[model samples]
Target: MKNDFDWKPLALVPALAILVFPFINSGSTWLTLTVAGLAMGMIIFIIASGLTLVFGLMDVLNFGHGVFIALGAFVATSVLGAMGDWTGSDQLWRNMLAVLPAMFVAMLVAGAVGLAFERFIVRPVYGQHLKQILITMGGMIIGEEMIKVIWGPAQIPLPLPTAMRGSILIGEAAIEKYRVIAVVVGLLVFGLLAWTLGRTKIGLLIRAGVQDREMVESLGYRIRRLFVGVFVAGSALAGLGGVMWGLFQQNVIPQMGAQVNVLIFIVIIIGGLGSTGGALIGALLVGLMANYTGFLAPKAALFSNIALMVAILLWRPSGVDPVTSR
Candidate 1:
């Protein structure tokens, strides 16, 4: 990593935002869209961060990661469903009480499942990219079927808590309250990840393991265990992201995770194979592009992100900030 911060990639967010401002022509509407885009980006980052970590550190592409996402969403549905009183309340703090527990439980359940997934499904295919892809994909299918068995094959509503249902006016722009919360949660997750990867001893060991596993092991550290930990953490993050995504859509389907897999892959690829910072940039750009294009040309909304990825890859073949260690 460079000693000094690279501001160029950071600048792209604002630059893109500025470039689109003129086309929107309406300040208030533009503001609303920008915020919404940011919120969506953050939720995506939360989900993608785990996969990036797992790939960056373990070099294991667990295609079944989406299963964790779906699991998390379904778990949150049950948790929130049981807390009808709190969700039904108009008090923000009260809603948080219900939401926080749901998030926690979802993470816990996902992490446990991740542990087993690593033990049985992913461990054997370590370092075999082809097998990893094939097996993990099969795992995802099994997971989706399991979800259907448990939650049924129908779409279920996952509405926001009463206090989070409306928008807050800022000047002439209206920002959804849930979007604001999503942004805050995303920022917090980012900050924690940054601090852990940059400042902690465990982080040092993990990064070192990534660069030279043998060297790290020579020092008596168990890099394999650390790698497993990374996998579980990644799975847990996916779960958290699932919960956020489910709420964002206000509905959950058995195949939601697989459907989201496409965007998740796009975000990670654009961010570079395993780069955290790159993922954030890629996600925000995707979110913004999707929103801007959706508003201007609704039909293009589905393809905007694909176009953005191609543009990004064309400009920086390996992504904006690929982890060079790999």
Candidate 2:
């Protein structure tokens, strides 16, 4: 399948931003909200991208994807807490030194746990969608309980490092420094995934396997192992997202992953279940709609994404670009 970049759907992000701009009136406020929405969307994309990959490539329901997210957040909290001196430092580099490790450790730990999860909870239910759903959700509940056992049943504060705590003045707008970081990171992730999937041998194998498992397997490439690797990578991405999310909220809780699960699902569904580009587009839309509605009509904020999803599905039930094909 040659490259068929569905650029039309991407118009939605800028369109939404532009549509909301007039209502916001002030340029600075509009920019501020737009930046914030992008940041939020990036975080959501980080979380949803993994599940999208798994569902698209491995065909696993993975309802427990959120557990990996929560695990990553909690792990980051522990690592960051131990590095008080670095977090307390006002220097941006020093703060990043601390955060970089926290993010790394979070991803590593979460990915490791995901390996076990795939082995025990998910391996048995392969190709069984209903069983996959039931078992993976059970796995998440169990993982949550384990989190409570280790981290306690309370929310733990995840304070931003000193240099990243405040906002940078962008003209009349006050955009957060961390939010800027988030945007950059999100872009980097998207770029990396795009390059890997579009250019690399491994990515080629994964995509081929998705389209025809037997064809790839016949070529002496263990498709199952490739999928396992994909699942692990997805889990790591979720873990990375979890760290960003924890810092974004300045707190962590056992249920945080489960809480965000709905948003994640909405995102993957809105974007084709397997398309990385779609996930990015969907996440940005959801993020923009959320911030816009939250500010415009606070009471209606909760239903905004659901309404958005409904609207999107009404238009394209299979999602923006159902990558399940090519």
Candidate 3:
């Protein structure tokens, strides 16, 4: 294994931030936009992480991943709705008591559904990329229909907890409380993932399995089980992300996941598919690009990320850091 670290890709986040600082002009607006962009990027990373994990380790193309996202969000609406007193409270701690449990329930449900999804929808199509893509997309459509049935076809409000609403002033810049929380949560998730995938025995085995499945299996480890666990975990992460995304939008809809799917793919592709670190960088870049462009040129907001993706590809055709190349 190569022991050298590449600081270049990592620097892109700050470099991009500095590059856009001047165009944003006002210090307050820049600060606000930067925080918002980072929060958005973090949420995107959470959603994309699971699909990337499944693809990297299991080599399964799960186009249906968005279903878990919507599922989790809808589930949160129910959970938070039921805990109205907790969520409605003015105390942040009280609000968290409700939100945390909602997150947990969402993850649990999404994971259970993911287990079934893998068994019924993904298993037969293994190693067939074309079949995986078509079938999994079909699965997503069905999953969306199921969501509409459970949550109704109408959009549902997912208001933030009382304490999480509004903004806290940082100098002249006003930042939403939830956005700050989002940035912290995203950082925590990234840190945990980096540690889990790099420092532990399971991480070692998973990496080894990806590189040489037969070798790992010959050593008496159940590679199949590991892959299944990864799928479930990935689904759970997506569910957690769904809860966050729903709150970020302050609403829940059956098709929300499908809408976010476009951004998720862009992030992973930019990050060099299946690379978590790359995903973070890709997500942040996307978030920053979207926010900056949206503020500067509203008309170009829609195509900004697409343009950004093209630029990145032109520079690194295989992505910022493809796992295969690593």
- Candidate 1, 193-270: lDDT as tens digits: 877877888877776665667888999998889988988898899999999999999999989999888888999998
* lDDT (Cα, tens digit) per residue for candidate 2, span 50-164: 7888888878899999999999999999999999999999999999999999999999999999999999999999999999999999999999999999999999999999999
For candidate 1, give the lDDT of residue 63.
Answer: 87
lDDT of each: 0.88, 0.90, 0.89
Which tens-of-lDDT digit does each residue in 1-326 have in candidate 3?
32222447978888888998988779999989999999999999998877887787778888899999999999999999999999999999999999999999999999999999999999999999999999999999999999988789999999999999999999999999999998899889988887777788897777666566788999999988999998999999999999999999999899998899999999888988667777888888998888889899989986999998999999998678676665
> Stretches of candidate 3 above 4 Å error?
2-7
Score every model by TM-score: 0.96, 0.97, 0.96
| Model 2 regions more than 4 Å off | 324-326
Kindly give the number of clashing pairs for every candidate: 0, 0, 0
- Give the lDDT of residue 182 in candidate 2: 97
> Candidate 1: where are CA atoms >4 Å away?
2-5
Q: In candidate 3, which residue pairs clash?
A: none
User: Backbone clash tally for model 1?
Assistant: 0
